[model samples]
Target: MDFEDACDIAEDLQFDLSGEELIDAYRERADAMVPGEPGRAVFLGYLGEFLAMAGRPEETRCLRGGGA
Candidate 1:
């Protein structure tokens, strides 16, 4: 599926999605969401989860306090 479709399905298929799909979904989500304080923290957590889902624990490790 395309990035748009991947973004649409990333949530339900989080663990099942691939690297590019997860990355695209990550960017898609960061663009759509990313509020302040609590919401930002939550978004970062989701970002880490997305990286993990993409088999990219390295990227998550580099993210300080889940920051972008």
Candidate 2:
């Protein structure tokens, strides 16, 4: 998946997905997605926010490259 596609998926997952579905979206395309460093950071930030909203702060912290 390209950056645009990743962004699209992120946008969808941001509002609608949670738990396993959000995880599945990332796992499905992580190896294939090739967004740049900035893009990757932005995507991760989005994912972190999503995880937080989903009541998964530990996962969000991991996404933020932080320790528990």
Q: What TM-score do all the candidates reach, one by one?
A: 0.45, 0.53
- Report residue 36 deviation for candidate 1 (angstroms): 7.0
Task: Give the CA lDDT, 0 to 100, for residue 43 in model 1.
Answer: 45
**Model 1 Cα shift for residue 20 (angstroms):** 4.2
Mind giving the per-residue lDDT tens digits that candidate 2 earns over 1-68?
A: 44676577677774887677876665444434464543465466666665677788997776556955
Clashes of each: 0, 0
Best TM-score goes to which candidate?
Answer: 2
Q: Relative to the true structure, how large is the alpha-carbon lDDT of every model?
A: 0.59, 0.63
Worst 10 residues of 1 by lDDT: 1-10
In terms of lDDT, the poorest run of 10 residues in model 2 is: 30-39
Cα deviation in Å at residue 10, candidate 1? Answer: 11
